[model samples]
Target: MPARVVVGVVTSDKASKTRRVELNRTVQHAKYGKFV
Candidate 1:
């Protein structure tokens, strides 16, 4: 159980970073009409 919790935390940290990057890129594209 503890191992699963630790793994979940690590996976979430990675996923959040990727999601944030994608969201930032999309917003920048919408504003500038170009890929950022």
Candidate 2:
């Protein structure tokens, strides 16, 4: 298999044991516009 491109955001880093990651995504709307 081939490697794919991925994007993510770090929401929290205060924890010493683990990290919190928030996946990024794009969405299109007719009136509301684009959202992350």
Candidate 3:
């Protein structure tokens, strides 16, 4: 297997030598089978 690269958004950056990242993903609903 190969290493996977993930991309996300930086919601905030107000710390000393640190960063805040937000990773989002969609999951299918159990009953409706819809991805949201």
Cα deviation of 5, candidate 1, in Å = 27
By lDDT, the best candidate is 3
Per residue, candidate 3 scores C-alpha lDDT tens digits across 1-36 of 659777899988999888999999788999999998
Segments in model 1 whose C-alpha atoms lie over 4 Å from true places? 1-28
- Most accurate candidate by TM-score: 3
Q: What are the runs in model 3 whose C-alpha is more than 4 Å off?
A: 27-36
Better of 1 and 2 by lDDT: 2
> In model 2, which residue pairs have backbone atoms overlapping below 3 Å?
none
Alpha carbon deviation, residue 11, candidate 2 (Å): 0.2
Candidate 2 residue lDDT tens string, 4-36: 777788899898988888986777876879664
**Tens digit of lDDT per residue, candidate 1, span 1-36?**
465321122223346446222122223477668856
Give the count of colliding residue pairs in each prediction. 0, 0, 0
User: Candidates sorted by lDDT, descending order?
Assistant: 3, 2, 1
Pairs in clash, predicted candidate 3: none
- Model 1: residue 15 alpha-carbon error in angstroms: 20
TM-score quality measure for candidate 3: 0.56
Query: How close is each model in CA RMSD to the real structure?
Result: 12.8, 4.2, 2.8
TM-score, structure 2 vs. true: 0.44
Selected candidate, larger TM-score, 2 vs 3 = 3
